[model samples]
Target chain A: MNRIAQGLTLVLLGAAALTSTVPTDLYLNWVKPGFGPFLIAAGVVMVLLGVLVIVAELRGGDQALDQEDVVPSGAAAAGDDGPARSELDHAAAEYAGHTGDGHGHDHERAPGVAWLLLLPVLAVFVVAPPALGSYTVESTGGSSGPPPRDENGSSRFTDNLSEAAPGEVVELDVQQFVMRAWVDEERELADREVELTGFAVPTEDGEGWYLARLQMACCAADAVVNKVLITDHPAPEADTWWKVRGTWVEPEGELYDASEHEIDTSSVEAVTDPPDPYE
Target chain B: MSERTTPERGSAPDPATSLGDTIAGGWDDRGDELPPADWGRSSSSRRTGTVWLFALFITAMAVAHAWLTDDLTGQAFLAWATIFTAISFQALPFLVFGVALSAALVAFVPTSAYQRFIPSRPGRAVPVAGVSGALLPGCECASVPIAGSLIKRGVAPAAALTFLLAAPSINPIVMIATAVAFAGQPEMILARFAASLLASVVIGWVWVRFGRADWLRLPSRTHAPNASKWEVFRESMVHDMMHAGGYLVVGALAAATLNVMVPREWLMAVAEAPVISVLVLALLAILLSICSEADAFVAVSLTDFSPTAKLAFMVIGPIVDLKLIAMQAGVFGWRFVARFVPICLVVGLLSTFLIGGILL
Candidate 1:
């Protein structure tokens, strides 16, 4: 891309980054909610820097597109109908000299793949995807049965907080619930009718479906899918929100099969998608 | 796109036509009255092209929104998009910081500053750079360009590589995160720090010893003398962003794809045997391409693994990974990465094993 195009892109990038984090939690779909303000500031700086470059280019301050690209393309310098200008338009095509096809813009120095950077920009600015679901989990093979953390490690949980008091149907995080059900030898959750929340997802094995919650340990990149198989109920329409009252059942299938962890359904209720989809 | 129709730009005497002028002075003009064509190069075409592309991209997004609103393919695409955008968003601040710092070094920082602090010898420079990395709090994504700038600035390549390897792995933010992730086991943090530092210095010396200058592809350090310092600074920042941002996308794509595609079961399966588990976790670290500051949480989550294996995971991750590989390929060419990655991996794994064996 030309310096002008690069500057405009930076300006757009800054605007996108800043807006994604502000006035709403829209950015939460892509990043941690806590990271919003820093992103806003970065966006602002990028915008300013972009403006600086644009003003410089407008004054013809920049002499060359870049000091040195791997392969300096069509250095036409707009000189007397330099035919090479057409060849230079493939900004990113020069990288590794991969494909010489006329795919890039007509800028001599702009990185050709520079256009691909807009893919994410368009994605965030437009239809922000929801948190990851079971499909990602199944595809990544992250459904590695329940972790063996039998000992509850939530520093948030205190001694007096014991199991669901009587039959109150205590609500639990799907992650905590799964961990407790699988290894809580005390059978703390065995007889308790616990409330759980998540969107419905199709099971990978095709035998059943799961009520799954996607958790982001860090960012969306590190999203972990925590699932509880709903044995008695067919999966609700994909990604439908539900609040279920269920009892933990003995796992079935191979010892290591993640699908073995099932929830015996007592009741299932429809709910709107929660603001925070992760545990 | 606007350039296509600009007849004025085509009519101007192309300074670049003469190979001598293109080589000596790319855009520098000796004439008193500037060519109107110079203005054409920066004219309405650029703005119009940007606006046109902007409208096209938005229309495409609208179509995508409709498709995503109703289809599963849209959902899958969104999943991929979120991961992709999250990476660029996260890297922006670091990119800003790095470019500003590199630009400041070029503009304000004097040659005396390097003479005063940095040693010329590779043996001493490697340690100095490795230790100085404690100062930078940015991620590996930020380091590639900064390292590139450092090399362009005349710092020894080995020293810059040391800084590159050390900054993301041992910086305070990363160390603290490692501590938090491995809380109650302070020793894991120590092991990671020592191992990562050791790995870095080892690799640096290896570069000093065996690295061929021709094999490393670097941007020329030449500067346009006529450009103002502010102009230079802005150029530095924009140039680095454009070059690094593209590869960051590539790296992020690999990270996101590998993250979902690599079965966690396989990682967990090999957790029983210590030797195999160390290799497995180290390989997983390369695949995960997670930020070093945040990887501790991931390591901690793998509860069944031995602490040594976790150390291997943390040490290897920042120094070498799919993301780092992509960035390296972008900045230094594939040849450099071909030789550099295997060497770093072997060194990173070996150091982690030795240190973890003793410390854990």
Candidate 2:
């Protein structure tokens, strides 16, 4: 039994290391794209654990058997084969209900069926499936499609650039228009739009930006958003909800603010309930 | 010389007389009748050999898989490894808990305890048992054995059957997981709860009206309420662990086959309407036999389908997947499993569709 246990453990471990070359039947075709890598890790763990468990059980059983074998043979010849009873054994002999004694219940020991688990267990380890990908992403569009579009042609923004006069209260809702004042339409307030209302989130460039509402079909876990890069602006504490009505500037190319220096703009007030909220 | 037995028995205290006196003393004479002390050792060795043979078989298969799949593309290798690991790791702790619990139930609980929980009226017992499932939480794989034990202990068939169906779904852990999976979308959770509850209740009633008591098998012995819980627990856990573990292995293999053989690109080509949607996913769920705990993660990833369709997948897989059907068949009679699975599948499908449509 010990040799067999050892042999079994070694073979499984070795199998875990062996790379299967069968191309067609090995990998699943319909699995999600990124799911494969994770599957492999899981398989290796399973194979190792399965072997460890069997080996441990085998060793434990062997030791118990060895101890039983050590009982003196002379006692057997004297017609006393059972082990010497201990005081603890007597104490422990509280009459528990019948434990498998004379129960006619036909519970068959599964001698061979347990091995059946191996085939599938091994298969899953060997043929790790892939994760969901672009197809899934693309298929998930609806009234739940991309975020709500602003009337100003931008799909995910608060307001187009609109220059506000100094001390002008632009009265921003933070949910509607883009921040910048640009294009042929907003040519009136171009070059100085200010203070929009939204959440303060970090931009991809590691700088602070005011990112506004975007509705996702699912939960916030998959929320898509639109951002307006704010430079020369005092960083609005990250994740703080604030209502800012700042001058919108088209700036030069696609740059967010023309104020080169981080805008230490004033009138950054935190407010609740922006009207006409998107999402 | 102490009691030279045989040939007048050397005044061995009249071995057959005195009735109960010297009960242990009588065993002294019997013990010497054996050829040797090592008689049982050979049997133990044989059993050990069998266990090893099984292990070796598994190892050989693994080696074959590795050799055959060695040439798999980088994507393929990653795919294989990730899925294997996820299932292996994700299911281990739960399996351990469930097996241990089942063992405890068997070892400790008295046969009559099952009756205590059973309702007096057929009319009353069925629904109570069905709804009472909220109390015990786990997968169907674990539930079947518990249900079987109850049946053996004289639990009302209808009630036990209801419990068998509903315990896996109505449990708090599953409900909470469903709620979180949908993420703030309470509607999905609501739909699931309503659908599952309705389906289970319906099944309970149907079982009461039409069930055959003989369909289920009972354990050989009746248990006393005073039975030691720990002993029962150990036995149940060991027995059930083997059964559930065996089924899980079956499921994983089938899932792997579907995963490897079916191309994702081709699956996407299918239509996404309710009919096509239900059919495809139902088939997949049947074939894949993913565990109920992990099915949610899989559901979240099936982005191509409607929320309603995915709901059907989740609801149906646990109730009537290929591996589950097989396990049920093995434990219960095939005739019983055959009738129960299809009924459950239909009910599961219809309820999921109706509920998902309204909510999603």
Candidate 3:
């Protein structure tokens, strides 16, 4: 791969990382807000280095290319093809910094596998894709039951759900509502009006949508769907972010059954997805 | 070949005094013209028609940007991309941390420092390297490139390999995290430590005895060029970042694809058979590739599975995964990963099972 190409790709990748992480949108899709600053710093460093590589090469510092360290010996193996070996040997010989054949850095070979590195850069900057949506919800069987324990493996409802006077409006997350419903023996939410916010995920039965939030443990890869059903109401548009004023209606089914701990919405409003969409 | 250096291939040159001249006439037979002095000032520094290649990539990216910005984002693409970027974002800092360390060593420290501490014999170095894993606190991303850099500086490959596996799995931070996550069951912490140590050492010994020289494409000892120390540090850092970052993405993509493709329901389908449970948990370890420090929490929460199965998940998550596979392939090359990952999986499974069964 050409050293200049390597440098430019670095610059682009770094730039994309900087822009994507600094904004609030990244929180919507993958991870928490913890890694934003680090990514920005890494992006700055990468761009600086990319610029340096180009400058060094431009100043007739072809020796800087030797820093590329095209050690062809690594390409050798017990049973490799002759052409692959020769191509590697040729590439190695071409960039033999100090103790091999005497040709300076050559760009003629093209960026071989190094070109693969550019794919992420393209995906990041070009595609600039968004977060998990209905397709993921459908594929992964959506938020199922309450976790085996309060995510910590304890038997009791771990969240602090204190007594709210009758008709008092209390705000809670979709997860907290479910946890209390699953394990709280005190029936603290029996008569309290609780408001919760999440995006609308369509029910498999097509009767209504579940107000759901995805809980990411580390990053998007391990996100767990935590959803509460919305009943006695028409389903809003799929994946529509919602803030609903409602109270918990006792489910006709067992605990954590889609119907069991659902919210009976007195009022519902459709809103845009939040900056940090996942819970 | 010099007495200290291992003989590689036949290409040799007359007494080369400077790195510059060696690169200039190095491949005298490979007739590629040097771009003019003013070529440096050009917008596209690429020469000999490579500009078109760069231009094509940029053009394709531009078109993608246009199509993506029109509010036509698909959930599938968005989900895939989000997962992809998240993996990259997560790995970015650790990879940079590793590159910074290796770069410092390459730029600042004399090779003699490594030689003095690390044993020369492959057999003797394995345990020392494996035990030293307890000291490095970072995850797998940090260890892979460092191991590659060490091999470049003449540390035995066996030792480097041993440290690569052990550092991420058995480090103090990971052990402490495991202890905290499994508060009631102290056995998990000890089991993870023992199993990881056993696996790493076993792999090291196996490599010492059976690993083919060609299996690993050992890194070249790239010395800092004649520049300021800052320049040397920057150069080493940049170079390692480029190589390692590229492979890390490949690993990330494989993991993201698997994350979506394999229905998450499989996690709930735990068979009662001990062997099946072990295999399922082991497979989950490969797919999830959770950070070593936090995997204990994930494992302990899975009360439906046997403790032994959860133990297998704890031990195997850090050792083998699609991400680790891609990274190992990235640093050590696919040749090494081809044999190495399979060997690791088998040995890691047995180690976890044997140790976890006895302890848990």
CAPRI class of candidate 1: incorrect
Highest-DockQ candidate: 3
Q: Model 3 segments beyond 4 Å from truth?
A: A63-111, A142-146, A149-158, A163-168, A185-189, A249-260, B1-56, B115-124, B172-186, B212-214, B221-232, B288-304
lDDT of 2 by residue, A29-138 (tens): 22222333433443333333333333333333444335434543223233221233222112111111112222112122321334454443354444433332222222
TM-score of 3: 0.80
True-structure lDDT of candidate 2: 0.49
Q: Fnat of candidate 2, please?
A: 0.12
What tens-digit string does per-residue lDDT give for candidate 3 at A196-276?
Answer: 888888888897778877766567776766678787788887888889888777655455444236778888987776788
lDDT of each: 0.68, 0.49, 0.67
What C-alpha lDDT does candidate 1 achieve relative to the native structure?
0.68
What TM-score number comes out for model 1? 0.78
lDDT of 1 by residue, B171-208 (tens): 99999988765656778888988999999999999999
The candidates, ranked best first by TM-score, are 3, 1, 2
Q: lDDT by residue for model 2 over B1-360, one digit each (tens)?
A: 111222223222221222122223223323322333234675345544554455445455446556755654454444444444334333433454555555555555665676577776767887788788878877766677777555545566667777877887677777776764565467767876777776777777777788665454333322223434543453344444445555555555455545545655554566367578767877777776676655654565565677777777777776777667766654454567767887888888888878877887
Model 2 residue B292 lDDT?
Answer: 65
Q: What TM-score would candidate 2 get against the native?
A: 0.53
A56 Cα displacement, candidate 3 (Å): 1.1
Collision pairs in model 3: A74-B217, A101-B26, A102-B25, A102-B26, A102-B27, A103-B25, A103-B26, A103-B27, A104-B23, A251-A260
